[model samples]
Target chain A: MSAELRRLLAEVAERESERFARTHPDDDVLLYERAVAPRRALRRTAQASGVAAVAASVALGFVAADAVVTDRRDATPAASPSGTSLTPTGTGWTELPEDSAADAWRVSGRPLDAFFVPEGPDEAVLVGADVTGDALTTCQVLDAFARFQMLADAAEAPLPEAPLSSQRLGGFHGLGDVGVYEAEFTRRAGAAAYLALMVEAAQMCRQAVGGAAVVNVEEDVAFSAVAGGGMRVDISRDGTDPWRLWVHVQQGRMLTVIAEPGGADEVAPVITSYFTAWDR
Target chain B: MSAWHGVLEELIRQRRSALVGYAYLLAGDRPLAEDLVHDAIIRTFSRARRLENVGAAEGYVRRAILTLFLNNRRSRSRALAKQHLLVVPDVAPPDDAAGDHDVVVCALNGLAPRQRACVVLRYFEDLSTAETAERLGLSEGSVKRYVHDAMVHMRGELGDIDPGPEPTPQSVVLVKGGAR
Candidate 1:
């Protein structure tokens, strides 16, 4: 064993551990009382009530999931089925229930229609759709590779050359524009590879905005799979330029929502609502 | 509600700092480390029967943290692109003095997840090779290989850090800098 390596490890151990311990300075008593005690009580209560408690908890969980979905749609304007013509069925394409939020943003006055396309033999389903508006003009489905190239250029991050099918679905509208952008590609590559590409694009955006008026940035901003693995990048300066840049991924699908901070509803729930239904 | 609370509270009182430090070592990010510790505490207390002592509970909780961390590493969410997970929101430029720390962490981050875990457990936590293998559910020889590989890589990245002492018959071999 190299003596120098041991010394470095020891230094890392001492420095990092000390910094963590010093900075955290959390209270043990509060944690026990606040976090541990409640769970303990719940366990006891559940044990005693047995079937009733179990039933109640299940109901509560369902209600929670429902509430989450509803809250997400609160800000989304209901889609007027009047404007959206029904696509003929049996093309392995499933029409998304008219979502007002999906219908709100437009490109060249055409109401962007959302749907699911099942995978076909010899090709993964091109769940071909994208949101292109003020912020997402660069994110067109056909230009995904160009978009990745652009992001790599801006962020100085290494990115694989966009897949042959790499189609850019949307681009950032501006500093404070708010809108929803969704894109799915049935690449020759697997879902995992697509997911990686989407995540890289989001990360590139996050890195590019480093010098901008980013007030708060929460990485790995969520824990639940339902929230769609995402990050919340809050950009505000002087309490005026408040906007949220949310980039979320599920399976191979990528959803990015840019919204004014004070908007009535969050984009997370809306994305979750659509994805949950798609999953079903 | 359960005897576990009494045991958990006592353990927290005694070992909260150590637990949090352990998590920080594994996670690198402070907030995630704290969250991991909190989650580990809840999980360890929630599932285990009332162990007789704090030492036993500490062991349970630490193992839970390691298991959770490793499992999380393998989980799909972290695969949010290869280096993307390592991307921090850069609000300000980092100071020059922090270079060594970042270098070490970057090197550490470069290791495969299991290798990183084995190295942390063996060197940072000062666990014996067998104990690290047991904790990770890997063979001792695997642990040695991981350590050896990790050390060799770190030396390349960091330039001649000490790899500590040679292995006895009972201990696993720790590769020195000049070996490979």
Candidate 2:
């Protein structure tokens, strides 16, 4: 590097450092603890449990574990099955893996990925979407979701009491009159970002009046068997379409299931079957 | 907390400014840069229980910061691309009022993430090609290519303006936002 270049770099670095110090002069310790303590506790808990706390729950068929790991080896991109239009367009949208869901829903959109709409007997569509950008701003993400729902406005649908798990990502699944919805099934960089978005959603939900918003974050994750790196399911309401339940799962990736609100007994099987299709 | 924890905490307090600056270069935005550094420090301390060496701890944290920035950038590209698919106009106005220092920062930002990282690591941190590659999980050749491309970009954008002698501490006035 030239002498001038080095001087410029140093100047920029020094000024930037000073700006950070001035703005966050007192946050070093608090930020450190907030970032480290929970992670350390999670690590200790995982160590004590032997296997991941959530992976064990996956064995019970309570939730679908193991992020996008299932689809990596199956490089064979199948043709879009009978009912869906899941073409891998040039715009970088990955082809949806062949799944039972493919038989019933047509998928569209990029990044938001698959926006499924049921084609035959299936009552709901599955949307595999992701919130990506410079930062995953909660308001922006919620806005995008709301914007996409151009039909009836999506209000903050109250999250049902979800089974809590000790996995890297929280997952939720629900089936009721409010409309079945599951969200945050795929893991991301970490659970902190996931939790942050959820908190933002909750706050927005609390502030929303007369259900003006499209989706709402659920509350009360039941804290028991939900303790593995397994996925937890949270249900949000699609007020625009109440008979159809919306499932949004975000872990490292995102998987959503929109199904007709059905019996409580049918919730688990329906969700697991969708996961099976997602994996296939 | 152990005595080691205290040592780690003290080290963080002392070097937080430098770490935040390094992250800001990578993340372009101030708040996101702070979040990256914060997460990197937490990750380093949480994983390395036996923090016998503060220097190595700093290095580990720096690497974590780079990885976090890169991962977020990659994910953001996909999301931004997808958002573009929604028939929205995504145009950013060029910096018209950038000062000399702001110009330098903007030039650095223009490079692709990997190339920009190479410049920061190789030139700013004074890391060797081998070390940069190892830290980035890339081969030395790749690091060299990135640095070469970055330098070409810097030279093109920076031209040959003389920055004069390094300003003394008292001479340099620290302002609020720079190259933001």
Candidate 3:
């Protein structure tokens, strides 16, 4: 039986090989240029920009978690040198209106508050908050945990052996129904690893969404690096309305902030505000 | 120009079709098989491995292809999610002229990714159980079980069709204590 199966497989393989060779006769120089060259260029760019050094430190497990956390705490107070008020008064941020219960509902009671929102005519509200340690895993496990697990297994990184807890926040986005999630990990190394995994997952998610046969749902994932040391993952499902997802691993905490549809230009301020609040 | 690039070009020029054929056996799709080959090439060349020759390069690419296929079982679930959109009619009688091709391919596809990989490495690639285990990062016992289970499934699918009295190859002799 085994021999027969082998013979059959060999026959099929031969037939398929001939057919594929005949059909795809052209040389794949384009594949090499597209896939291999960009990776090489990216490596050179990383080496030049000093990002490679930070990656090496994280990979070596030599990053000090305490120092990162201390830096964040120190940076927050330094922003307000007088030490009188923690919240920014003239930062173009306004307190939520008391009667605007619906808008408040969009921002209130999340793990974090609406310290930052999109600065445009459309009222973009804060949708997520800072959840640390196990809370981060609990919030994101259903959506991206399998990807994290696969990446960790591939890299041989052992995850913390703690039970993940979950809390589902319910509400509808001003544009459409969008989900906002936030989480922070305890260790900088783990956070850094997860950040890398999230980038890869974003790429895979983009492919999955593009390949999905579902009609009338335009899904996309656009990932890019922020100016500082973090990455932003933008996921758009509704036509022309992108749901922005920001992931920052700083000060020994991994922060993921997701927001509903707003102007793309408004992303930087929100990130800056979140980091400022996180430092405090 | 680079050593890896030269080796990659040579491997593509020489072994691209063979690699695609191997991937097609695992993926059971033409376009996906080609994608797997291309992805495997990128994965192999992205890392600075010491590929001394085209043979060594081919070996690395093959391993990468296998890894990519096994890791991408998530696509199976995505396909299942979209199965609702597919309309199925009544089953037709098996085509006699097509021989056992459909039976074999369908049986191969029905097996779990790892099980199918084990069967391919065992029968198609003619590797020993230990070699299959090493390639798949599984224990020898696990490889034996997967191969055994795969053969049992194939046997059930193929039914009692006699394969004539052809002699088994020497490589098949090494796969002892499993499915024999």
Candidate with top lDDT is 3
Per-candidate Cα RMSD to the true structure, in Å, reads: 18.4, 16.3, 14.0
Ranking by TM-score: 3, 2, 1
Q: Which stretches of candidate 1 lie over 4 Å from their true place?
A: A1-7, A26-28, A41-280, B1-7, B73-99, B162-180
lDDT of 3 by residue, A179-278 (tens): 3233445555555554554444344334434422111211111123221255565544333455555555553454444555653333343344445543
Candidates 2 and 3 compared: the better one by lDDT is: 3
**Which regions of candidate 2 deviate over 4 angstroms?**
A51-280, B73-98, B161-180
Per-residue accuracy of model 2 over A1-280 as CA lDDT, tens digit each: 3556666776777777876565554644644554344334333322333332223333323124444333322323344323224222332222333242433323221112233332110122112122111112223233233112211111112211122222111112233321122333233323323333333443432243223323434422222212222222222234433222223233333333333334223333333333333442
Quote the lDDT for A134 in model 3: 24
DockQ of 1: 0.17
Q: What range of 10 consecutive residues in model 2 chain A has the weakest lDDT sum? A: A150-159
Candidate scoring better on DockQ of 1 and 3? 3
TM-score values for chain B across all models: 0.71, 0.71, 0.73
- Give all TM-scores, in the order shown: 0.41, 0.44, 0.45
* lDDT of each residue in A237-274, candidate 1, tens digit only: 33343445565544335565555545313445444443
Report the C-alpha lDDT of model 1 over B1-180, residue by residue, as the tens digit: 345656767876667667766776677665566556666676566442576678888988888788777767332432332222132334533333366777877888788767788778887777888788777776677677778787778778888665675432234444332101
Residue pairs in collision within model 3 = A112-A129
Deviation (Å) of B58 in candidate 3: 1.0
